[model samples]
Target: MAYTGETIDVDATLQRLNKAASERGFDCFSLVEQDGTVVPYFTRAAKTESAPRIYLLAGMHGDEPASPLSVLDLLENDLLGMGVDWTIFPMLNPAGFRINQRENHQGVDLNREYKAPTTKEVKAHVEVIEQSEPWDLALIIHEDWESEGYYLYDLPTELTDGWAPRIIEAVSRVCPIDLSDSIDEMSAKGGIIAPRLEDIDTEPKLMGHWPEPIFMHAEGKIRGTYTFESPSSFDFTTRIQAHNAAILASVELLLGSKR
Candidate 1:
């Protein structure tokens, strides 16, 4: 089946990526739901024996088309060709993708349900991260409809040195940043930006509840995990460019800065 218009053909997209990996000799796998919707994942084997592991994910929210599409674009374009143990979970909510909804078919927000493991989608993502083990950095891509700017949520780690600053600066280069030091300032933007985990209320109904993957960083599970939100107001082509630039900047900041 072909993915007509701007919509993605999930199966064909996965096949394309896997075919690319096979042709280029990169490792690849699919994360699937109980109903058999194939979720694409790829692991690029390191060129050298010593390259470290890096994890990247997008589309935890089904409605956020930019992140998932961007993820596919990067994979299709061979962004992980560099020698590294790269694990990319391209999309988690295909049903949500189909309807352009934020939650899955069960109407659960996969992002908030991570702590409780109430949804299959969230569980699958968590399982992948746990199995991957130690990672130098984890980059999660996301998008917001009412966002007035772009920002990052980072936790403390050794990778925090130059890479952290670069991530912040590079995003600010193309979008306005909401730099809030206090909860009041953070909340001023209508909940588009993620507050520090400590500042977030875990109330079930609140968007901040249970916190997003940024909170997972403080748990010592992953050293540094960050989420980038691209505003949907931008034209599709411009949004795609912004999304791709962010991916390139992130990979270069973590992998290139290490060299």
Candidate 2:
């Protein structure tokens, strides 16, 4: 139910991040620091003003390396096509990642700290979110170490309703869908968990553990969001590919809408 895999070279992984971002013309800033580790932010403006503005994030939990790795693969291979302004936080819990643990070195789950952030990482991340413009879509990548296959959480605005199935269909080519009727204690259907957005106050999970996506939506900072979770028990390569497909599917939808 937890990540107990081989040791990871977090420093090396970050180095790859720096290189990939620089090569792709993204501007990297070390805007957040926690426990002597800096959480970097990457941004690239779309070539045209009409392009959609997108927000992408990964590696909230240190054990979920596949999430961030998928971003790295997308950047290194230039798979992220043009005409979309991008704001990316590739790794938020470098301290936890350094130790291969789920929480940060301080033992706080950064994702759950958005409501009242005690951890420096979440505080900085929250600050950035407040200052930024509302995104057309937000893509969050994570992995459930206990899950049997890939799944996603969908929080949509009117424009984005019914998009989760398209993403699932795309990911199905590379990964198995988690068809559980209940996922993460929430009712799910067809590999999608659509939380009751109107019941944030009544839901214990949303009330106590304010995830990044929920916080953004509650604040009206994102038009839509998808939290992709690849089953960590599966092969690393497949998990990464699943994340890649999920992201690409979202982008494909955005571009298709414009066309």
Candidate 3:
């Protein structure tokens, strides 16, 4: 399926994803079903028990087409073959993706529904996390329509202290980095927003609508999480390439830390 800057065909995308998973020996499963639309997840285990368990998630916001597209690109190119236990949620909001909307069909933002999980999708995702082994790292791909270049939110941890910089450098090769001193109302340096855990804790409204990374941290599901934001204003190909580069760089960093 060639992506030619046209509206996405969600069914075709899922077909390609399933085919890639089958050919690559990844185990695929249905994560959840919402209004007859089933969201799928794929997993590939590492050869060694001590290997890091890494999670890759995309398509939380349907308007960010590049997020899921990048995951598909990586799967097709075998970029996810690195020796790490992998669990990938390729497209979480299929209902919203169908119409190119940020929110789901019910007008709920899936990304912000992780706290209470009022939506079926968030509930299902939370259940999977609770029933599975803890993840060492999670890489979430997203897009900001308001941004001019790539920027990321890194949950500050010893493992992620300098990791975002490396990711930014890698993505810069494919897309420009957001040089703004402030991004998303948070202080950012070198296109990276490394927020302290306590700082995140003080946000009053965060209790009601928690983003996925925050939910993962709050539940002790992952030690580190990086939310990569590609500029939606860029061309589709450039945005996809930028996301793919960041994901690969993040995986390399996590794997190196395990070694």
Candidate 4:
């Protein structure tokens, strides 16, 4: 089903996420516009200065409302209780979410503009990543319709033995991990697709025609990077739940790794 092009007040959504996080004793900040014309990117860190910072960003593409909604679910559930500093941008393209469009107000793909951030959305994301302490891990929530199943993109990281596989298994319990066949289809388009929950031991290719922004920004400093793609082919509610599952699983895996 096509997403209804109705207005989604992402600012309101951030307000809800912030309120919930605050009530749970988390440190929260919203980098929003003054006039409320744009959707502001908000980051929520744990109250205590913690070990490794974990960043979760969603809604780079306007049409992908599920990403932001999924993150909201985590906030409502007090998922941050799991630990690690969090920098979450629930919706990068506020205008796009309002109209269910794929790009930002400038009609530029925020994901593709990371190398040269053209829109305010990309700039804000860059600001958070650069300003925050070196992230130990990052999980960006995304959606793709051309694929038949869910997928993940594992970036080059230093510690892969226990961390990567744990994320894959955790996610797979909720959604079937895309096999090599699905990966082939996505690779045909350019890069490997994560049809189901998956991981990569080696560093992913970070430079090419359409390189990943996370990897480009988090090359040397970050310990791990991953991308979660929930297929829009599934029902919206199911897709949103899948996104939440991935987020929950990632947090658990990351926190468990430290122990």
Candidate 4 clash total? Answer: 8
Better of 2 and 4 by lDDT: 2
Per-prediction tally of clashes? 0, 0, 0, 8
Worst 10 residues of 4 by lDDT: 194-203
lDDT of 3 by residue, 1-259 (tens): 2222345799999889888976888999999887787899999998777889999999888888899999999989888854899999999998888878889999998887887888889999999988989999999999988887999998887777778888999999999999999998888988998877776557765657788988888888998899999988789999999999998898889888878
**1-259 in candidate 2: lDDT tens per residue?**
5697554577888899989998999999996776787778899998887889899999889998898899889999998776899999998888888888889998888888887888767877888999998898999999998887899998857867778899999999999999999988888898999887788767876686788888898788988889999998898899989999999999988888778
Looking at model 2, residue 135 earns an lDDT score of: 93
Best prediction by TM-score: 2
Better of 1 and 4 by TM-score: 1
Candidate 1 local Cα displacement, residue 139, angstroms: 0.5
lDDT of 2 at 43: 96
True-vs-predicted CA distance for residue 144, candidate 4, Å: 1.1
Stretches of candidate 3 off by over 4 Å are 1-6
Order of quality (TM-score): 2, 3, 1, 4
Residue-level error in angstroms, candidate 1, position 80: 2.0
Candidate 4 per-residue C-alpha lDDT over 93-163 given as tens digits, one digit per residue, 9 for 90 to 100: 67777667787666766676555665665666666667667777778888876556677776545553445
Residue 46 lDDT in candidate 1: 81
lDDT of each: 0.64, 0.88, 0.87, 0.63
Give the winner by lDDT: 1 or 2: 2
Candidate structures ordered by lDDT, highest first: 2, 3, 1, 4
